[model samples]
Target: MPHPPVLIAGAGPSGLVLALILLKNGVPVRIIDKERTHRIGSRGAGLHPRTLELYAMLGVLDDILNNAGKIVPTASYDFGELVPKSTMLLLKYHEATPDVPHANTAALNQDRHEEILRAHLAKLSCTVELGAELRSFEQSADSVVARIVKTAEDGTQSEETATFDWLVGTDGAHSVVRKQLGLSFLGETRTETIFALGDIKVEEGLDPNFWHMWNVGPKMILMRPHGVTSTMFNFMLKGRSEHLMNKTLTSDEFAEEFYSLTDRRDVKFGEAAWMSNYRPNIRMVDKMHQGRVFVAGDAAHCHSPAGGQGLNSSVQDSGNLGWKLALVHKGLTPTDLLDTYNEERLRVIAHMLGLTTALLDRNDRGVGEPGKKEFKMHQHGDAMRMLSVNYRGSSIISQAAGAAGAESDPYAEAAGAPVQAAYRAPDAPELVPAGTQGAATRLFEVFSVSAHTVLVFGGDTDARAPVVDALARFPPGIVHAVLLLGQEHAPPSDAPRFGAVFEDRAGHAYRGYGADADALTVVVVRPDGVVGVVASNAEAVEQYFRRILIAV
Candidate 1:
């Protein structure tokens, strides 16, 4: 196969998603994995709403929702039958609030999730070059030179060097990229060995959609329903299991241990698919980008999958980085924008580490001490686990105060314009009624789509004159122009106000910019619908368009 300009070091979720995003934009990408076949292990098994939103953007949400397991909204919090409480609070607090239309999460095994990603990857005709390992890579100012070895089925190997504009490492925890780059992974490794995990089919009369947790003093047992086929059983032991770590255990030993610990011999196992004893360790790479090469997913950070965030976070990391890389390669943006990757992700990682560790500490009992203590308590950290991520403080978003009220619309009754000067909300309103009239409603419609919108405020029907004349005079593709009135807050019923003139309802273009409604100010939102620039004055709007919009 011919070499592509961009080379991705791993074909797991992150690498594949990154490849797909780039490929969609006509960027050439080559994805390679060391494994001879795709992973079949039911590794990570949950997808948050934010992830689903990303999948939606990738145009695969429905496919994923159809293929993955649907997580039940209900959860049970109990430790050794002592204290029992509902887990609704955790779900409510952590999940995305209803203010944004998209909410909730889906749960599925990692292997199945990868299968979905692989299916999408295939459409681009980018095949996974299996049995190929990245041995080393060198990065320079303009490009990356890397070497890989292709291992034949019978064990013979050959090496070759490839040059690419950029190299991304989505490799797992034992990342060769980190070693080659000499980047330090700073964090403590918490060593506790008595843990074992395997996937088993539940009894014929059982249900597997809800997440089930059993806390027996120092030991914590978790059962998560996969698809119609099976459930994953995880046992967290307080002490070290040297023998189990050294050699595999029989299915009878697993059954015996389960009955002895929980006294429920009814729990059963099918043919063991995969079994392993592992120690939980937490760590994060000091940096994500090094010149022409960048690391993501488990390569950039590794933490205990206690909150089921490993795969989710990794996919999100790619979500954050993919678009930026595409824009940079297309010369639509500066490469400096890539710096925001480490800044935004590291901050999120620190917080997730704290929450996950806190949750684990609640269930932790000293090593070698089993059944001595009860469960600490479980609470939902879904919002932090799922949404509310912001790049607000990043260099990408200019730190300017937002404006408020009807006077906020700059195009309102412009000079020589026969438009009414009706007052509207000075700032963007927090929550507008579904049918609320005013600039805020219009701004909401504009922010829904994934583009920078040029809102001509207070434009009466004929007021389209000045803006239309100016827009036609400006270069094409610089900005999307939409005329709005101060009084018409609700979107047009027959035709959507944003996206295209006759388009259906979607997101607000540029986050309801160019109006000073209590809910809106002149705002330029990123394609992801997060605010990038906030304008309070009409001059600021003009200047923003002059500087940023004109270039695009």
Candidate 2:
């Protein structure tokens, strides 16, 4: 097609998700990968609850949940004797409330996750160009020109140059994009920690419903069920530096060591599907963007796999950047809006790096203390679920005068409370307008990645008219107005005259938003599902949009 709007140099989860979201929003995207074929291993296996919610918004949650496995209890063994089991159920799945629909972590192989994303990408009429490696790129004031080498099956290579409005590098840790930008991937690489990981079919006797772990002194072996098959598992082994350093283990060797460590002669190993030697590195760039070029996913930050934060953080980075990039490209928002991608994501990555690092340190310390060595699934608090991550202090998020006192720090919250400005917009059930006697629809169903959602809450349509009129001035698709009325309010006779008008039949929508029914409140939900601004009047709402949206 004509020069695409965005060129994504990597087809991993981050790049794929970024391209998919942009494409779904009608932004042209060209995605490329160095590898000729899609990956095959269960590399990153943990999907946080926050990521699941994002997937839902992207229209891929059903595909993911259908193909992924549930997080199972982890069982620890010492010389064939069973120890206390550590389950993620510490925050049980049943605890999921209406506001937070996905409360539990999910287990899915990264390769399979990418497959689901690829399928969705296909629906958008976009296919990742394989065997196309980004050799180098240069960015000017208005565009980026990139040189890519395309390798054919016959081993012939051809180089081509293309220009795009923007460039994003989602390539992994050794990101050429970051290096070429002269940005430092600053951090430490623990020479002491090395792991041999593999995906292999296992013999009978081992329960696939539980993650099995064995810790013996400086050596440890973990076997987790792989994909939907109980007979296959993703295995990881950590041992003395000498044992893992620059070493590759064969299938027999891996199986032999597994039996020796666990002392379980009954367990057998089949063919190996994938294997690799890895060194844990905790590193990140000082910033995520340089001019028109940006780096995301493993390119922006990488850490120990202790908590499986690498993939989750990367996916979120794209989620945070996609909408901003789309709006800017469409000329609906100012170019400065793109700056918030770096401002918002850099802090989140820093916090995530610290979290994963701490977990790594704990794992290291536990090695010496046998009592603590018993593998227990980390008890993930709200932080691990990523529900607590916010942009409360962001420049774009404007709150009412009194509401500004809620919290200046994005990471701080008052234990349990309704969603706040600069925080994620929680989901709520909305009644099908007053006249229609039907089931309630979710708040997210009405939200889109291409527009801002204006939620006017109160029983009085007359009071909400100004806010509706303020939104009406903007382009039709740029702003979506939804009227959420109290139970007592009558549904408007002419529903089509107004935008989507729903009744807060159960008060869940009002309570979830923490809005007082007695007072009028307008909640501006950004394309990314974060509450951009909370205003008491239409004037404040107009001013908020003027600051970001170009047409306003």
Candidate 3:
């Protein structure tokens, strides 16, 4: 009998990423898209640091950084010049952020970004079947069966059939996969058609390092330097006309507008690589998962690109879903864990929506310091809190915790009793926890790989000695056991289960898992490598495995 395929719909970023992650974890997957070929149009143009880190962990960040456009930084304030401003405003405002190593964002269009991802997918010995379109699906007790039709590059069409244990809808905003499941996209489409985007060549004189924006009037224009070229720029115009939303801007029309907007007829619009009109809308699917199928990226939730959150949030959505789905496939976790993706992601999306709205309407009018902070809080949130997306408050988290004792201690910095001396490297940030080698070249190398890491946090070998004894048997097939200890400590290399002792200065592993200076901390990470359980004591630690892994 043939093994059930993990069928994926769509070959965009989300679908491709899900395929890459699952394949890396030893799961076989097949991806199909209706498009006859990859998109030549420049779609999304922003790549946040977190997404880059995920790609890096997948061993593909170098490809993106080397091939894509280098992102130039710009500062914005109401009625101020759109040219680059002092970094002090950004740095000071984001003072409380944990020092995660990633670009805040870079300017790489969707075409180039997906090209890099596709290259990586091909390197994995798998390829997407372009021109393949999903027709419908039926789910049985154990698997989902899907019907697909492939159109040959030579203009011939044929049918292909496949069955899978699971299916994911990454087919974008108008996803057929999402509709086939009968899920409702519960949100409102924007009433105003205020934004239009296209790519054009810049004039002979312009700073290549600066993002140019004109925000002084009702119509706002945002232009960014494209690629390594000084004479090309991508522009977005905001205003409404009856035909603005539907009419395709002709090359002459686009060129005329460029000169009018900049008040320079000398500026010419060269051949446009791609052009499209989009209206900002805030929409999210009421349900992310149903039966054995799931939705992600634009198929799950989409919000206004007020702060360029659409693609970043979608990437995050898929990243969260990919790890959980991988765990269930490996039999290390149950279906219940899937519910957490919606719980955690919905809350994050809500926060982002609020921020995008505020940034769009920043008047500095009736807005006091509190209002500004509220708006900017989301920006800071993106920089500071965005790095450590947690799975707590998730349905599967409690199940994953599985009776880890929760005796609250007032003196505790961690979840439980306090430890006298925990591992603290000389260079680890005092504020951001121990073991973060902030932004070093090897930073992602040490912390970003996908692994189910078990962090035993304690300096005193005696207190943590029990955990060392408990987890001393399993190898990499089960979990990656990491004993986080301070210096002035040593252990036998031949110890049974404890594989590697990762110190503080090595990377941000300790802080990433939300560790504290507790006497004994045992954290069980899922196969996608997100933290699952943080056991403060031995009884709680033993109960975790018994409930989730040991018991039926």
lDDT for each of the candidates? 0.60, 0.80, 0.61
The candidate that achieves the highest TM-score relative to the unseen native structure: 2
Better of 1 and 2 by lDDT: 2
User: Would you estimate the TM-scores of all the predictions?
Assistant: 0.77, 0.93, 0.80
Instruction: Name the better of 1 and 3 by lDDT.
Output: 3
Give me the displacement of residue 93 in model 1, in angstroms.
9.0
Q: Model 2, residue 200: what's the lDDT?
A: 89
- Model 3 C-alpha lDDT per residue in residues 1-552, reported as the tens digit of each score: 674368888888888888888887777888888999888755677776657667766788787777676445443333333333331122122222333455356568787888888888888888888999988888886799888888998999998677889999888888877888888877776665457788776655456666655444555566677765656677787653455446667667666654555554544456776677777677777778888898888887776665567777777677777766776777776677677676667766766666666655562222222235533432333432244434444444433323222222111123332211111111123222224443433324433334655667664656777666566543245556666654323443423345555445443435554455456667665543344566776566555554344332
Candidate 2, residue 134: Cα displacement in angstroms equals 0.3
Show the lowest summed lDDT stretch of 10 residues, model 3. Answer: 418-427
lDDT of 2 at 253: 80
* Alpha-carbon RMSD to native, per candidate: 8.4, 2.7, 6.4
Q: How far does residue 434 in candidate 3 sit from its true spot (Å)?
A: 17
Give candidate 1 misplaced runs (Cα > 4 Å): 73-99, 203-206, 228-248, 365-377, 402-499, 502-522, 536-552
Question: By TM-score, how accurate is candidate 3?
Answer: 0.80
